[model samples]
Target: MAKLGAPPMPWQKYVSDVALEIDPDTGLFAHREVGLSVSRQQGKTELTLGAQVHRALAWPRQNIVYAAQTRGMARQRWEDEFWEKISSSDLAKMARIRKSNGNEAILWGRTRSRMGITANTEKAGHGPPLDLGFIDEAFAHEDDRLEQAFSPAMLTRAMAQLWWASAGGTTKSVWLNKKRENGRRLVEALWEALAVDLSAPRPRACYFEWFAPDDMDRADPATWRATLPALGFTVTEEVIAAELEKMDPAEFDRAYLNRTRRPTPPTDPNVPKGKWPGLLDAASKPVASSVALAIDVSQDRNRSAISAASLRPDGRVHLEVVAYRPGTDWVVPAVARLHRLWKPVAVAVASGSPAASLIDDLVTAGIDVPKDKANPERGDLAVMRSGDVTEACGQLADAMNQGTVRHLDQVPLTAAVNGARTRRQGDAWTLDRTNSLVDISPLCAATWARWALVIRGPHVIEDYDIADSFA
Candidate 1:
């Protein structure tokens, strides 16, 4: 893991120790099947990655299979995040990488130990005596066909183990739902019946979860700190609060709180039920090209938003609310972080708006926010004039009205768009951030971000996103 530039965190270490304990009597893995459930942005991915690398290198003639929801994703992750790091280091000499179309693998020459990435199908683990199987993105599974196949393949290995891991999922995740319920039942029974000492190392089945209780208040910072394992590391209160403001209640619960349930419609949603719902597309993602960002604060200064816009290859603009937090303090640091990550054409803020107040703070942090209006460059700030604000708002309305735009099914952004009202900017109109019934900062930020992207051009390198990247 140190060689991969991703040493395990404290929680990872603890979880690995518990879940990977060896049975003293049998001299084999205590846990045959382990389920790990945690919120997103935690180091769960890194934990699984480290486990696979260790198994491949340490065990002679061992075979390992790692899976995501799709084969392309699994292969991409293996090359970009896992193998790339090893190939650059001393580990490359220890292991050989094969990139053939259907025969991709990482093989250690001396031990003949090998690892492979697989597609999500019943045959994922077939044709191999698997020692370690790390099945990821379990939330996306609707059936147990893959598990049934993998478990049978692992039966031949003396030290075999199957790890089915994911965060919370919607009701459609039938397989994961059953596994979670079983794990929960075991945990409770062990606690009540005193089946075995909690500290003892006898694990036929391992269930580790970090989930928020049903009764806790989602908005409470204390609840967040207590529920999320990676809260302090990189996912701060500010980041979680930002996520809360832009995401659907169900999504926020599932992704951040690890509480999966049916997606319920808000009783009296701020966003209208009509046109906006039709535009909800969960698969829409912004390309790295023509990237632009914008910052905004609520009228009361109680919250802030940072949004992104990018030109899709199809020539459509991808507008997204990137972040929304509780206060102004974290906005500058977040902007700086995102700027470094995306390297967008510019970061925009509307003049006379609450976000404009951050100009000085942003400048103090060495992020360039030019006061006077000039031709803005990449790595510089784009301050929108009153006319530009109206133009941006009008452009966004035009796009939405024509159904030329797409958005991820985020409830907050949808509500913001539906609840937004217009204020006269001469003949044109601007989003009324102050007078809107619901907070419209996210929508305003998205509009300005899209405008900036259209006016500027696209430029960004492909991302090698770290699995353990917290903030």
Candidate 2:
């Protein structure tokens, strides 16, 4: 903080105090993992840099790694922020900066310790005995691949510490969401134990979160201070108000108030609120039931997703995305391969849609597809009209609302559901690709699959039908 010309906020001080707690017997940090969830631009980076400086100075030959979502971001933090701070401080005389091959480091000559900054990739945080690992923008990490790679580097250092700090992300943030949930559970447990007795054991991990209540008014000044510790100092209420005017309310809530925007039922009566979550089935698994395949391509045709809908034994519809990839070239082959293996009752595709261009290719591959919807028995393919698309979207929404459909809780699908918007076509409504903030291809695919499953009832699948013919 000294390098940044600032004092630690009260919340930052509290977090630091807990994170630096020592196990007297072992002479190591009590908490090996420390997590911080706060609003953006609240001096988190500064605090982390100060911690890195302290570790570099206190521990001789300590190896510290600072990781971000991208290499450019990591380098900016070190060069633009950390370097400026160190240059302005007395530590400048003791530190040496080096850059090479997309990697940068700061070496403390006196202690023989160094700090490295890079993007979080599969190969990052390796080849060093790490004493400290700082993961910035933790919410952007959708999986644990980078964390898994970095964990082994700390195994040899008994005093190693790992830190994760970020603002709340969307529903698809699997890793960050898990960390927040675990932290909340631990905090709740600790409070309950403290209510009964004073000498209760606390959780070993530090989970620090500062957020406003869900019901709080976002426009109120009190709410700003309650969530943003730097509101009065580094940032002012006037500046935030000006920003609020330019930003979306939901985005402002997530970035400044540290809140997750709950999905509300659209006033246009598209998808009902709370219907998606009610349909989640954790125990849902793939079975031998008759399946229908639906493929959806993004508006830009840069990405496509294929989904399967099947009728479970309990008579409930189950949907899942089987494949998602970049570019449209992989759509035909992938669908054909899945068709040969699964032998789906029908492959649904919308006419005049982005995916419609692949119907000819599918037919050329010796796959039977309906050339026209007028003849129902033309082939295994189901050609959908604009009216069919609207009806399918409505059916899927109604099924979820009535608990007649179940899903495996796929992250991409969940994200699409949360961000999807609706637009009216004549008298019917469909997902609005032009206005949707996130990709809804998964939801679109599921809708077509559901419609196909309804049109084609259950079919008996013989063991021989599962032959691997798509070599």
Candidate maximizing lDDT: 2
- Candidate 2 residue-wise lDDT, 233-267, digit = tens: 78999999997999988889989998765555344
What lDDT does the true structure give each of the candidates? 0.79, 0.81
Each candidate: how many clashes? 3, 0
Question: Distance (Å) between predicted and true CA of 250, model 2?
Answer: 1.0
Q: How many angstroms is residue 360 displaced in model 1 relative to the true structure, after the best TM-score fit?
A: 74
Q: List candidate 2 segments past 4 Å from native.
A: 261-471
Give a tens-digit lDDT track for model 1, residues 136-222. 989988999889878999877888889988999998999999999999998887776555565644338989988887656688898
Best by TM-score: 2
Residue 200's lDDT in candidate 1 = 46
Q: Spell out the clash pairs found in candidate 1.
A: 242-324, 242-325, 290-458
How well does candidate 1 score on lDDT at residue 285? 88
